[model samples]
Target: MNVKGKTILITGGASGIGLEAAKQFLEIGAKVIITGRNQAKLDVVKKSFPSITAIQSDAGKEEDAQSLFNKVNDLGGIDILYHNAGVGVPPLNLGVPNNNHLKGAIYEMEVNYFGVIRLNNLFMDMLKSRDEAAIIHTTSILSIVPSAIEATYSSSKTALAFYVQSLRKHLQIINSKLKIFELLPPLVDTDMVADRDDKKISPAQLISGLIIGLENDKYTIRIGDSKVIYLLNRLLPKVALNLINPNKYNEKLIN
Candidate 1:
């Protein structure tokens, strides 16, 4: 899709991938409005990118979703619904059960999975009404190749991937102009994974791949090592599992 002159709404736009994408979209001449839960962060982003619109809204809350829809609806609808809001699951500590971790897992589901669904249901009709529109979900390679340390996170993305897959079929059945795109990105150098020294791609690389994918109409855009990870998981599940979660199933732990 042409980024120029499009009305784009991105959730969790305060930082990381969403923030970077919002900046790039603005540079492409799109009317971008970004939503985040932190008003202070939103204000900071707004100041930095005066041309972009920033709003404070929690993607995990139904009322906030409604408010977001109302606001966007007032702006004459959005051309792209970018579901970028999600949280990482806390690192799992083996051989010990932590109640707080369990609670964090549940919260992760609410934000990563349920919130996307709720916002999509609310904004889907608007997108369908547009002549050219797309819904982009920022999932992860973990959806295809699970990591035991990120159990809930993997499950949530897997569920979202399933939903987006099915939604594509339904859209085709109705002959709708709406396009469903899933962005599966590998570990990137973002605030979300700042501490990690894993082989990570830059945000610029991620957005560059995204634009190329969109221009070519790649429905499922796999960025960085995600494509490799996906194929390995499909063709050699055990090897893929061992590579992604070595700590969880180390030789010592398994033996």
Candidate 2:
């Protein structure tokens, strides 16, 4: 769980939470390598943080995942793989018969859920070979309670949350020393949600909490409203559902 002196590869590191995490991890003495689809953004990150190794790669592409693994292997491999790349299609009226519904769902699944699996499969052996290694999954609070407005996004994160748990148990059964950590973050102040009026925690706050969790070996790291929603969902599912999908969102969904 010690991050110092470890090499961590983070996906979608050009901006938002991933960029913040890269900065914090670098400050803590971890060698940070970040991947993003945009080469220009990667260049900007590389220029700003000369210590970070920025790579242009798309997380959702299988070919890109294999290429990234090869590139990282040539750079001496990584001790941690952080799955932070996720995409959410614009809100669609699923209740109405529309072609875009399935398309949006598939796109979300491809980037947010399947992308993690692809990278994990590519890096599993490399991670297992390390003396101390870990995999971090950035799932969302919506994984606990579905958001009517962002249904596909919620489903994608929920799928990933389940997979992370199962993967952790599987690794444990095999007596693997590699640690699996699931980070459940509430609404974050990032480009992805810039249009939303909902309250959000700064990326710095979220990543700071994540660092503390990593240092202490906390497998399930829930920050901000994520903690509250998780507890409420466990005790009062209806209340938790209402909290996530308020009247305004419900009205939007109906119309």
Candidate 3:
């Protein structure tokens, strides 16, 4: 879809991919409203990009979603609802178990899965009312191939991916023009994975792929190496699984 002359609402837009996208969207002439849980971060982003609107909202909470809805209403409705708010896995290495780790995993589920659902439900009517609209969910490649160290994080995305697919199918049957797009980005070079030494694509690359995918009417946009990973998982499940969680094959190598 042409991003120009559109009103886009991006959750978790204060930093990382969301922040970068907000900047690009603003440059492309879209009225961008970004929501985050931290007011200070939002304020910082506002100071940096005065054109974009930044509001503090926690996607994991119903009240926050409602408040965001009201805030969007004030901006005259949104043409694009971009679900980017999510939590990364805890820093604990694999094989290390703790009660706090379990809690963190559960929290990831609430934010990564249920939070997106809540916001979607709250914004469905507003989107359906618009002449041209789209819903983009930024899932992960881990959904296709679970990360051993981030089991809950991967699982949450897997569940969300299924929901998005089902929602798309329903929309198709009803002949609704509301577009649904899922973005699978693998190890992006953002704050989420800044400390990692693994190779990662820049946010600019991700956004470029996204725009091209949308323009070509692609339903699922796999950025960078995610496309290869998705194919590997589909054609060679065991191989893909082993590749993602190399530790799973460690015992065999040692043997």
C-alpha displacement of 169 in model 3, angstroms? 0.9
RMSD (CA, angstroms), candidate 2: 0.8
Error of 2 at 247 (Å): 0.8
lDDT sort, best first: 2, 1, 3
Candidate 3, residue 10: CA error in Å? Answer: 0.8
Clash pairs (backbone) in predicted model 2:
none
What lDDT tens digits, residue by residue, belong to model 1 across residues 175-195? 998989999999889887787
Candidate 3's TM-score reads 0.93
lDDT score of residue 208 within candidate 2: 99
> Each prediction's TM-score against the native?
0.94, 0.98, 0.93
* Residue pairs clashing, model 3: none
Per-residue lDDT of candidate 3, residues 1-255 (tens digit): 887899999999999889988988888788999999999999999999888888899988889888889988987889999998899765554465568777877788889989988988988888988888999998899988988667778888999999999999998999888999999998888887777666789988888788788778798999877988888988999999887777644553233
Better of 1 and 2 by lDDT: 2
User: In order, what lDDT does every prediction score?
Assistant: 0.87, 0.94, 0.86
In candidate 3, stretches whose alpha carbon ends up further than 4 angstroms from where it belongs are 91-97, 247-255
Q: Give the Cα RMSD of candidate 1.
A: 2.3
